[model samples]
Target: MLPSDCPISPLPRSAMLYCEIYAEVKPGLFSSEAKSQSSDRTMDLGLAEDHFSRPVDSFVASDIEQLKQAIEECKRLILELPEHSEKQKDTVVKLIHLRLKLQELKDPEEDEPNLRILLEHRFSKEKSKSVKQTCDKCSAIIWGLIQTWYTCTGCYYRCHSKCMNLITKPCVRSKVSHQSEYELNICPETGLDKQDYRCAECRTPVSLRGVPSEARQCDYTGQYYCSSCHWNDTGIIPARVIHNWEFEPRKVCRSSMRYLTLMISRPVLKLREINPLLFNFVEELVEIRKLRQDILLMKPYFITCKEAMEARLLLQLQDRQHFVENDDMYSLQDLIDISSGRLSCSLTEIHTTFAKHIKLDCERCQAKGFVCELCKEGDVLFPFDSHTSVCHDCSAVFHRDCYYDNSTTCPRCTRMTERKQDLPDEQDVGS
Candidate 1:
């Protein structure tokens, strides 16, 4: 409190009024040294007010520290006042204002690491009347018109622009790193009790018995999420595409949708190894298999042929060089393409080009072709020919009718066996 004789022309009216009220309410709140301390505090407040007028970029470490001290001073003054009193309430509001100012001064970019999830945040235009979407960081209701907010494209993580920098939670898409393989089980839901009756994402309390908060299940992850976390977003599940050959979009949680979106193009699913019967049932898959096989056969010829190399024949596969490298493994996108006949049409075009080069265009490639051993025919037959049969053991090509007539036995294998027998006899005779 200031002395009665001291001049108080420099101090603000509000500061003077506060000092008078503080002294009256709690006389012992300030000591004999209070006058000097209060003067210093008034000077600090004056400096702080001047600093607040300046831009946030101009705020130095000392300015932030001064603001923090002022905030603490406000809290201490509030604690000394009576409960529910106007003075206490006023001080509390001041403290909150000071804290907000401090937050504004601090640079969020300086504190936070670069976010790993590449969130494609879009301005939320449509508002749902039934369920209010709250910010994931602050849990404040997002008013579409009054408050400008963003929702992630893939994960659907919603937040106000003010709360975005404060977000520490990694996106559901990033969480997919924990999963080494795709979830094969269809909607493998462990009951809500298993999840402790909480959301799989935010851990917010969720209950099926409750009327307002109904738990939504993600068909992809088989985990339950609250309405905010699961937006009924649909995506093509990789497991479904591989197992059931189903490309239909199914309801999935935001995280699952994001995960599926990322995995769609990744060639990790070994379709033939996982479900071989798909080849028998799906005609497109069967055709794809045949085309891949022919591609593999043509690979050897293309590699050895100078003319094919000059033409860059293998470049015909483009991004699908994997078709020649491996036959069985396919991506979810590959399945989707197959379903639409796009992949088969593309492979057919590639196969035709490769076939043309191997059969007629290049002599080096033609020289690699097999003569029908069973028929002793002068005509050369490529393994890719429809009427030719390949030996399982020796891979020798023969005319299909002649092979079947020869009891499907490989003539090359018989000759090799006879050669081995003759070698043993010759060694015994030499000994």
Candidate 2:
């Protein structure tokens, strides 16, 4: 490439030897252009040396270009080594096309050697690992086209099941009603719009049409409730708090501490004005208290009499008329012979009157006595002989002789039986 027409300089023998060695050692310097070689030699040597460097530069230029092309080819193959198989010729071509596109995207101002190297390294690493897109939640295959999936908005975790209740125990109503007709578009708890969210109640999409967003009632008295238990009146209370005698003395003194809500059509000021501490908070407290007192007061009657002279009083208004009945007629003669209402003395007096009224199989044997088969407690039996007698209250079989001697009733229930079936019409016999 360089011309051999410049003048040669007479230099020191050592300098001449050094110039020739530099020319031979570093061929790239001379291969680029003759002007460059001549200028360098002019500073380092005379006019004769410049002329010599020009010719030498031409010879090196061709060799250097060949070496440069070889290196570039080697770099290309290294970058495309992952898809270099003969069977993957199409892949190789595709990679080459991609490389060309990357080259086009190089920095215009700066040399893009680093950019090209980075692209080549990344492409090779991806191909070697056969990296494909997949969902982290389900590990399902993913393509670039799928933009939206069922993902937890809170954690950004994608999942297949639309609702989380598949593992957890959902709200009771949600378990009962798996697919709610009403699809909700918002989170009920937060009152925020959620297209993919589910109702905590039904575990299904909430609809605006069928299901109500808020519950009409709630199980918890003083707490916020989910939509599920709002309408359900009977909610499970903590047995520890409700049933513990130490915490609640009413439960042990009474049987239970269930608070029943009673709605009266006509709310009276007298009923409403009374402090619930003095009386209960219910509208019909006066009547309810009277009924309960009567029932408990007449428990001796219920225990002694074969027929339940005791009215079954319930705390709930709904159950008030459950056991109500018309009064039975009494014979006028029996009323005159025995002092009417004399049995209503002490509770023990009533018990004795009801016991004496019982018709025993034999006065001595006392075989025909009513007794619970399970507990041997109760009165109501007939004279069927000494061997076997049916219990009036329960299916207890007892002998006449054994009835009187057994002072203590059945250990289980402690209920005593009167040895006679109290006839149905006999309620007013001693009236």
Candidate 3:
């Protein structure tokens, strides 16, 4: 400690200040050696993995909302910190960790932040130890000992769930089965290895595996189509041309304009074709952004009939089977593109010619024309109004008169009465 006698001269003022600024240990930057710093960063980010690495099924909406709130709070804290404070640096590092967790919850796409708002999240039955250590997502080396992981139950591919959205891959074939009732019955082999069939339109070598992809089979036409070729079948926008575009009219449009951009940008994605309901939701937001009221005037603006909604959902399938995963239906690529001038269609255009099947839900009291089961032979259309009555005893809804005439009491109520009659009275039991 006898440094008072030491002859070392002081450095320049700038150098001394620089050292002082850097001398304080930063949040994520743990050490001077590159290897140590790298390890430190990994550990810092791994906090999320430890907390949220549970199977997707285990997480409820509340848990997800909590994580989201935490992320926002962290951002706020960081913003309030002084620019040069070590606390500020630490908070920024925390923000990165939080963002990565949020990313795991989204579908992959281009510059657009999220693919869609996933209402129900799905996860594989398998986890880190059961699956491979390599990330199927980024194809980066991920050590299982250090990081947690997830696996696809359909393809058995191990990756971070977020990684599932990054690249185009074949569709999962585990759910396909023969449908005898299907009028159009041509199906080429669809197992993972059969990448031989060519798309009818684009002639891209297609695989039934449905990876990035092969021909999408048409059970209606007995044909297979590549994703781009199927775009013609979907009729969203005229083949990638910003100008002179003609969007084909459709009752059930699968992919959105934003989805096309993601495909072009080359992010692997695991998703099903979106149902019309979800698509219209995205479009409505677009309408609000652009102030286009035309969507309100459209015929199918509101959907009341569950049967009709199911019919539109049927249009989402390439074939009459559930997809292993739905492709990203949610994306802001069209808006992003319009803003960046990559695609045409201004926000203000009443008819951007999207051919979008915009839809709305009926008000609670407005539903009508439901077939009444009680009027079995006559098959009358029962309005949800005066015509409808729920049984007091059984809670079954039926036409009011039909229920009263056929049986004064519901069959379930009658059975319940008979059962009560057979039971001993409480007084008798006491005696």
Candidate 4:
């Protein structure tokens, strides 16, 4: 509801845009011919309806005719799908996609005012389209068939209003950000959305709405993963360690990261848009220093070898002699700035470090049943119709059967067995 002073009454019959909204915004205020505010204490507010956000007019005849044609063409394509050879599988997929799109267009119940605004942002910069054009994204016809569309003036990439979200790469047409990120929900690589939630790992249907609980979602990408793939409780490191690192809701791996977490090193590289400095640094690590793929993929956020070792995060360190002890974190941002002749550190100490510092109970990566610590088996060896039991202290994931077999103690807990007596020497050591 609006504030107490604002009226809920309907707009008057002759109420035009600005003139009507002025009273609705500030009831006691009056506008002068000069169109300047008489009061400096004017509230910072906006009208419910403004000149920019005008109501859309009813569809004209030509627009309705084109919509009908598009529908007819989609139906025709569906009928032809069966007759074509199996090589034309994309046609079948396209038909299904078109049906979903048509249903969305027809459904008035879908509350997507925000989505509509975001989709229109791409069209805001388009110039006149006097000639026919094809959509840059779907490679579908735009102008002749669907007249109300947009084309990037610089690159001439044409697209339909609904299809504005199919774009992925940096706009060669312009370097401007889109109006709303919500409209671009479809993953450029994986064609999934809230309506069609799918597991990024398992490649199967996942639930976002209408379920006991929704699957874990990526913060950046909005992709969902099945519970079996990404359980929320697998912490392996100290709580502070997990909190120290930066994380986004985006899935970093190009594919399913079987036993990885979304907690990534800052200056994380999107493999497709690799910065030159990062690209060169990676080359030095992989080619010149000959680092393993596993080590490179870890991409620890630390700067010097000493910091990693002191932090007790080198759970999987292969070497110690190669690094110096007292160095600050390697700064990729500084390196990039220096390359542009900003005169940063001329002899930046590039540290070569490899370590895994996450506490099995660490806050970043979730608990996943992988390689049963007791049985030495793989992939969360749970018994039929039961969840894997994880040790709270040690962060080891094992089946209930394994837990019982080990007499209720996690194999990796590293504490003395309950039956073991504390000897005099042990007590002294403890003290």
Question: What lDDT tens digits, residue by residue, belong to model 3 across residues 1-431?
Answer: 11122221232112222222333333323423312212122122234545446564645566556667776665545444444455555654555545545544542222233222121223342324323355644656544322344544333445554455553443232211121111112223354234347765445777767766755654223356666545433323322122212233322112222223223222121112222343343443343322222322222322444543654632332221112122232223332353354332343342332122221233331333234455654433322233556665655556777777775556556777888886778557888
Model 4 Cα lDDT, one tens digit per residue, 60-163: 45443444455455334333333223312333333333333333344322232322323223344333445556565555555432234555433344566656
RMSD of each: 13.4, 32.2, 27.9, 26.7
Could you give the candidate ranking by TM-score, starting with the highest?
1, 3, 4, 2
Give the best candidate by TM-score.
1
lDDT of 1 by residue, 1-431 (tens): 32343333343323333343445544434443332222112213323375445565656798789887887677566545544455555564465456545655773323343332334343343334234577866766765433445666545677766677677556655555556468877778888899999989888788886545778888887888888778798998877777787888989976677778777776778876788888888998888888898789778887888888889989877777678798887878888999998998888988898888888888888888898877787678998887888888888898888888886468899998899889989999999
Candidate 1 has an lDDT of 0.70
- Cα deviation at 40, candidate 4, in Å, is 80
Which regions of candidate 1 fall more than 4 Å away from where they truly are? Answer: 1-57, 60-178, 208-214, 242-244, 307-311, 424-431
Each model's number of backbone clashes?
Answer: 0, 22, 22, 21
Ranking by lDDT: 1, 3, 4, 2
Candidate 3 lDDT score at position 232: 37
Candidate 4 residue runs with Cα over 4 Å from true position: 1-160, 163-216, 219-332, 335-431
Of candidate 2, the 10-residue stretch with the lowest lDDT total is: 249-258
Candidate closer to the true structure by TM-score (higher is better), 1 or 3: 1
The best candidate in terms of lDDT = 1
Model 2, 1-431: lDDT tens per residue? 11232122232112232333234323433333312212111111111222212242223444334434433443333233332233223222322333332222231112212211111111111111122344433345432221222332222223222122232321223211343221111112343233233343334444344343532222222222333323333422222211221121111100011121111111211222223332433223343333333334333433444343332212212222221221121121112212333312332343333334344322422334445344354454433222444445543555555654567664323343232345434766866
Q: Model 2, residue 65: displacement in angstroms?
A: 76
